[model samples]
Structures are given as structure tokens and as C-alpha cells.
Target: MAISGPSPFLRYGVRIANEAHTSLDEAAETLGLLGYAVVDSGLDADQLEALRARFNAIHAANHASTDVERLRAIGEVDLLRCPLADDPLFLALASNPRILELCERLMGAGFILNQQNGIVNPAGAKTYSQSAYHRDLPYQHFVSTRPLAINALFCLDPFTLDNGATFVIPASHKQEAFPSDPVIAAQAKQIAAPAGSFLVLDCMVYHCGGTNRSAADRRAVNHVYTIAMMRQQIDLPAYLGDDFSTDPKIRQLLGFNHPTARSVEEFISQRKAK
Candidate 1:
């Protein structure tokens, strides 16, 4: 007997149809296999422009604020936390139908937006907090049959090699602890994508921002979606207040319905209300 082609044992692993067409299909297949995927964001020129403008305004405002300066002192530079609170545009991006669909596929229904952050890798910075490899669900050390959380990072600028595209360790989400330094160097992959693309990752995957050797800054908005049981990075409902969105789906995504009860009476009231 002669085995001329690839090993049949390859069939033992996760397999999808060769004809898997559509961005969602590709994203699902790759996320299942490599712990990450990139798909077009489908934002037209005008939308992109508006998002960029709003992001810049927020960045300027935050940069001068005392809170942001405090954060910068600790090496967390150009990181905009909860941008959705400042502008509705970020919320719209976070609730993109395709992104939500992908999150539903991986995390099942009732997933909530754990965090939304606008990150900038400044030009010629020595290092930033995100330069260190860490999971979105930091400090956790366990693998799940399915993803507990996922990150959809919308690239606002071309993610070129010189501009500091994100670096990811392929299939690292399956491991409980970070691999050794040598293993990381061998397996690390830099993800270079266009401006209107979303880099989706399993939150368990170890990843970090690359250095921006270019003269321009690299900008992105990151949204982390997790199962409803997990606490949000910020109490989004409280932060955004009641006027943010009237749509139930949008409200739920912002964790309006998942707030913790402060007392036994409140718990009973919530259950009754439900």
C-alpha cells in the first residue's frame, strides 16, 4: 500500500468544507483552529472618516485629563477606556451585526460587551502596557471547550509591519500557561490587516501590540464580548446612563440587564421583574 497524498490522519482534526465561503465562515473556521481571525469591517469611507474624527477628539480630550495622565505615568499610554461612553459612534461599531453574530456563534446567546477600548500605538514609543503578552481575560489559566470571551479589534489605520500590527501566538489559546520564550519567538505571528478590518481573537489567546517603527500612529477600537455571567470591565449601564440606547438588544449588549443586585430584596425584585 502506497500513501501518496497528505496523511488521512489529518481528517481526525477539526475540518470545515473546502467551499466555506463568506467572511463569517472563514472567521469561525480560523478562530476554532488558530484562536484568531481577520474579517472586513464593511465600513464605507464616510463612516470610517466619522469614526476617526470622533476618536481623535476623544484622544485629545483624554490626553489632557488628569486621569489619563495618571495612567500614562504607569506606562498605559494612548489607551482610551470605554470610548462608547464618550461617543455613540463607538457603540455602533461595537454592535455591528456581523461581529455580534460571530460572538453568538462562539459564546452562545446572552453574551455582553465586557469592554470597549480605543488603543493607539504611538509612533516611536519605547514600550506600552499592551507590549507585554497577556490574555484579554488576564490571569486566567484554563482552557474551555468553547470560548468564554472574544475580542473584535477594529483597525482604524492600516496595520502594516512598520506601523506595529498586533502579534499573536497561533493555537496558544488551547494551552493553560504561556509557552517558554523560545517557543513564543518561534510561534509568534504578526497580523497585518487593512484599515477597515476587524481582528477577532479568542480572549484566551496570548497577544501583544507590536512596536510602531513608522512615523504615524496605529489606531484601533477593541471590543471584548463575554458570556453574561462575567463582570464587565466597567459598569457600562451605570457609566452610559439610561439614555444611551432604547433598543433592547443594544441595551442587553451593554449589560443593562445583567447588573448585580445590591441586596436580597433587589435580587427578588429583579427575578420578579424578569
Candidate 2:
């Protein structure tokens, strides 16, 4: 028996490339099947400039202090953890409605922001923590029927082959363990996206940041949104203080309503009150 395209005996269906679908539909579908998708953020020039400026300023401040040596010791460099605590713009970007829509589709209602960090692939750097391939929920070797978390990484600079675009293994989220080196070498794909675009991913996807071979740094802001039951990377509600936002959605997204109880009585009371 000759196989013309895919074998009819195969149990799985193959998606046709270049199908006619709306942008949101394409993003949702790709995120499910490929473990990642790229979507235009639609930020204007001024907005893009503002985000880039903020990231640069924060990056400089972090690098100027003892934090640089401390981070470098742990193989982490050029990272600004929880930049939203420093600027309102970062908070706004974290809660962008378009991003929330996709998060809602994958994570269902009431997903909370797990972490937001500013990432920089320094020009001509040999290695950094992010350069190593790992899952957003690192050290886990399990697959979920649905996504437990998703990363919405906003590009502040255009991602290119010369400037360290992200490398991802498509549909790797479905596997229980990291693929062998040969499989990774054969299947890893570099994602190129313009500034003011997002490279969204299933948190389980195996991916890494590429080394920047270009003359300039590549900057991005990464937001991880997870199901509300998961602990946040940072205690955002506590870190941001009680008065971060009056909007109910923003409050909930920041984990304000999901605080831990101090005692059994408090836990029962809190549940009853809810």
C-alpha cells in the first residue's frame, strides 16, 4: 500500500498549513497544537518607545547594583524580575485585554498573573540562564490535557536571527521528558517577530533564548499567567501593595483575592465569606 500524503490508518489528524482563519482563531489553534504562537500586539510607535525606554532604564538600574554580580553568580544576567512593581506601564501591559482573552481561552476563567519579568539578550553574550532550554514550570516532566499556564512575551525589539530570536520545539509540551539532543537539534525552530508583537507559549513548551550575534541588545517583557490555584512566582498582591488597582479584574489577576489564610479559622471564614 502506497501512502500518498498521510496514512489513512493514522489516528491523528494533521492541520493544513495556510488555512483561512481569523487571527485569534489561528493563535488559539497554534498554541494548542504547536505549543506556541505569535500575534501582533498593535502597539503604536509611541507605546513601543515607552516600553523600550522603561525596560532599558530598569535594566540599567538592576545591572548597576550588586544585583548584577549576585545574578551572574546564579547564571542569570540581564533580567529585571517583577518590573511591574517599578512602572505602571508594565502593569498595563501585563493586563492587556487581548492577552487576557487568549489566556482566558486556554486557562479558563480566573487565571492569575504568575510573574512578569523584563528579559534582555545582551549583545554578543556567550551564555545566560535563559539561553538554556527549559520549561516555564521548570523541572516538571508531565503533560496536562489543557494548559496550566501560558507565557505572553512582548518583544520590545524586533526578534531576528542575528539578534537572538527565541528557539522553540513545536508540540514539545505533549511529551513527558525533554527530547534527546539529536531530536532537539533537528526540531528546534527560531521564532522571528517584529517589535510590538507577542510570542505566546504553553508554559510546558521546551524553549530557550538564542545568543545575540548582532550589535545591539534584544529586549522583551515576559508575562506568565497560570490557573488561580498555582502559587505566583512572586506574591504580587503583597509586593504591589493593597492599593495597586481599583479595577476588579486587575485585582483578581494580581492574586489579591487569593491570599493565603493564616489559620484554620481564617481559612474557613475566608471560604465562607467568598
How do the residues 1-274 of candidate 1 rate in per-residue lDDT, one tens digit apiece? 2234555554556665343456787788789899999988889989999999999999888777757667878876678889888888898999999999999989899999999999999899867668889999999999999999999999999898888899999999999989999999899999999997899999999999999998988899999999999999889988888887899999999999888999999999999998
Q: How far in Å is the alpha carbon of 134 misplaced in model 2?
A: 0.3
User: Residues 161-269, candidate 2, lDDT per residue (tens digit)?
Assistant: 9888999999999999999999998999999999999999999999999989988988999999999999999899888889878989899999998988889999999
Q: Candidate 1 — worst ten consecutive residues by lDDT sum?
A: 1-10
Pairs that collide in candidate 1 are: none
Number of the top TM-score candidate:
1
Please list the C-alpha lDDT of all candidates, in the order they appear. 0.89, 0.89
The stretch of ten residues in a row with the least summed lDDT in candidate 2 is 1-10
Model 2 has a clash total of 0
The positional error of residue 180 in candidate 1, measured at the CA in angstroms, is 1.3
